[model samples]
Target: MNVAQVRRTSGESIHFDVVENFSPFELGTESFSFSAPVHVQLQVINTNKAVLVSGTIETELKVICGRCLEPFDYPLNLPYQDEWAFPAQATEELLESALLLEKDEVDISQRIFEQLVLALPMKFVCSEECQGLCLTCGANLNQTKCSCKEEVIDPRFAALAKWQAND
Candidate 1:
């Protein structure tokens, strides 16, 4: 999770394969949860004044469907790349654009967590053809059909329905 050795060398590259368990508490999200450990394959390359980190993260997440409110397994394989540049004896403006490295190490856990959060979709569904639920009977339409009348509408939308009928 921390690139300690890369900071010691001027131009060194290191490869790492790590498996770590991440709890839902760490992610701070109630929409999804992880039942197994996540695998990360990373490569850290140290340049003269920068450290380049690149990797792929793989995991399976249990997420709730937004439409049907059902739980389903979602698989993820995301690639991430970033650079942390050390301060050089250059102009102050140039140093402001680069990320300052911590004392002889660069922690990548926060970055990986942020990437996973951003990679998640705003809306989750079990399948593309999911019929969701019936509003009147509160039944899963994908599993069975409901006998409730489909023409029922709120009174607030009665004017719109009349206009739609005229069109």
Candidate 2:
């Protein structure tokens, strides 16, 4: 993005509408792919000391269910807000969280990538009632019930169970 215009005067602002495609990306151990093009609508404002960029990123993602391990579509509408401080006004706190605008042009690709990563959830479930998989036969319980008999007690606790029953 070209910040030359907005940086020329305080209170000056610009609006941007961007539509682009991104390849599959990984967040920790999970991987995600975009099912649709990413759409971004943003406004950039010059506040003399800093430039404020706020926007929304919309997309549909193909994700795997953490429980059932099935593929599903997850829609994302993420809000993004960040600041770029002028060299003279840059403070320690701002410098740690934001980037310095030393030049007329700024590349926001890194910011966008960070936003996507931060928006990811720790776990993904297809539904609340998902039965997950059978431990003995490794079968999807949601689809079918396995013939293996379930033992509710841990093998290590079997001796304790008998002692408690006697008491």
Candidate 3:
């Protein structure tokens, strides 16, 4: 991202539409792979003191379903926003907390990566109707039916079950 135009004149803005292919990244034990390049539509605005970058990002990721443990494609579309102080106004604290616009061009790949990671869901499921795996046989219920009988009773609450049955 080149901010020279915006930096030269306060209130000046520039719009960009780009597609980039980023390297794969991991979150804990889960690995995220991109099926295609990420699409970004962004605007850079000079606010006198700081430059604001706001945009929409879209991509398709290959992820394992948290329930079925099967690989599937997940489409993601999200909004992103960030600000960086101009070099003259960039204080020590601002530099540490955010970013400083020092050069004519800025490599926002890191920022985009952070946004994608932050927007990830806690659990990735193929669908809401996903049946998941069978607890007893470790069989994927979505693909096939399991013959293992479900014993849902808790041993600690066995007495309560018997008491309720008597009533």
Candidate 4:
């Protein structure tokens, strides 16, 4: 079951269980994992050509931290709601497919996955106070301190330091 089927609620008020093992994003990515599963319950309403999709997906996601470039795991509770149009003239077979957009077939799961992928913070700091890697030695500050002096200021500004002493 995909997002489109899940979003399709009958006239009498329908509910669907949405499921997808892999969202197609992990196919060629180096840092993302395909082992995690995605599942959700969608409640939808279709009025004319308009379809409303609302659901919550709770699953485990594996991604490499943008900061340390190390893979990490996170539990996701992704709430999704979107309105789309699959024309009344559209083939019934196509309308039932997941992520079906307007005149053409567009999978909602793909876009939703894109949203989930893009929504992730570009920089994932291990903690709020993460000191990050040492600029000079490329040492992970969270694990160890670098022997290189941090106060090695540029020589061009050396004269500025002595001005404070004279004042």
Local distance difference test scores for all models = 0.78, 0.86, 0.89, 0.61
lDDT per residue, candidate 3, 1-167, as tens digits? 88788988999999989999988988998888999799999999999988988999999999999999999999999998888898799888877766888888899988899989999999999999999998888999999988784565666699888899999
Ranking by TM-score: 3, 2, 1, 4
Q: Rank the candidates by lDDT, best first.
A: 3, 2, 1, 4
lDDT tens per residue, model 2, 40-114: 888999998899999998888899888889988888899989889999999998899878989888888677877
The segments of candidate 2 whose C-alpha lies over 4 angstroms from its true place after superposition are 91-93, 147-167
Residue 107, candidate 2: C-alpha displacement in angstroms: 1.5
- How would you encode candidate 4's per-residue C-alpha lDDT over 105-163 as one tens digit per residue? 33656656765776666555556676676777777777788888567677766777777
For model 3, give the RMSD to the true fold: 3.1
Candidate topping lDDT: 3
Backbone clash pairs in model 4 (N, Cα, C under 3 Å; residues 3+ apart or in different chains), count: 3
Model 1, 5-115: lDDT tens digits are 887788898998989887674345564578567888989888877877788999888888888888988888999787777656334664565566766655667777788
Per-candidate TM-scores read 0.77, 0.79, 0.84, 0.61
Off by over 4 Å in 1: 26-31, 88-98, 149-167
